[model samples]
Target: MHDAPLLPVSRRQMLATSGAGFGMLGLASVLDQNSVHAAAPVAPAVSVATANPLAAKAPHHTPKAKRVIFLFMNGGPSHVDTFDPKPELAKQAGKKGPGGKWMPTPFKFANQGQSGI
Candidate 1:
């Protein structure tokens, strides 16, 4: 018989392919009786531990920074009264907030030889 020209697969063409499932496995089992009757005696049974395609593994190295601390204050207190104060902040506290609203300083500042916030 002469070879026929191969036809190209077109976008409009529809395919009807039925896959082999458990029924095909059953058929394979029925038609595979010869495999059970081996001519030579079998060797000792080996463990069937196949390599896992998706298995959990340990990380390569130790991680640092076990904790994260964030202290959020809506309107922070006066700098000088609380911690290291800057005289410039007290000089311009109510003048204008960080976002432009005139937010008064929560606490008072003073001149401790070093100008207070």
Candidate 2:
């Protein structure tokens, strides 16, 4: 048996295959223009003396606290064991619970700061 000869792709076939990519580019441009025009007007920019963006600016209204920092620990230390120490948990350690016996925290906490968490 003889094998059939492979045919080369024509310019029309190539253009047809690539038409979707060109269409997507055109659609993206149109969507971007619509979004730009239809979007809400930007608020007037706050005038700053310094070039640095990190430089602190005066709040519109007086804030109770001057600054705030948020710490997010994903799959980190348990809150009860670390921040909120429970002495009763130590006494009830090794006691059976809903699933298994309760385990005590290894770290010992002490009163430190003036606030004393």
Candidate 3:
């Protein structure tokens, strides 16, 4: 027979009741240690907005342009149409590629600008 006395509450209930006390006990020990170490004077609080580099600031000079045009082409232009114009692919248009049959762009890529880039 078990010699231990049975409580009115279940094991789960006992644990739930004592859990907060155990947490507070641990917190008290931490606070006591912090109090001893934190004898040094605290620094003055600085404005976070002013300190932040990304914070918006007034322009140094008066702006000439009132409106801004932002062309956000998600994929921009295709690599085949812009930079890499594969002449061999044009010759073998209906040939098999690495991933199934190669589909070439119908439009002709011209040398653009002085740099031609």
Number of clashing pairs per prediction, in order: 0, 0, 0
After the best TM-score superposition of candidate 1, give how far the Cα of residue 110 lies from its true spot, in angstroms.
7.7
Q: lDDT rank, highest first?
A: 2, 3, 1
After superposition, candidate 1 runs with Cα above 4 Å error: 1-82, 102-104, 108-117
State the C-alpha lDDT per candidate.
0.60, 0.82, 0.79
TM-score of each: 0.19, 0.35, 0.34
Alpha-carbon shift of residue 23 in model 3 (angstroms):
26
Q: In candidate 3, what are the lDDT values of residues 1-117, reduced to their tens digit?
A: 879997589898999999999999999988976896666656748754668868787789999998999988787777646666677878878888888886776878777878654
Model 2 CA deviation exceeding 4 Å by range = 1-82
Model 2 Cα lDDT, one tens digit per residue, 1-117: 999999899999999999999999999988986795666757647645455678788779977996899997789777655777778889999999997998888988788888675
Number of the predicted model whose lDDT against the real structure is largest: 2
How far is 34's C-alpha from truth in model 2 (Å)? Answer: 9.5
| Ranking of candidates on TM-score, top first | 2, 3, 1
Query: Which has the better lDDT: candidate 1, or candidate 3?
Result: 3
TM-score of 2: 0.35
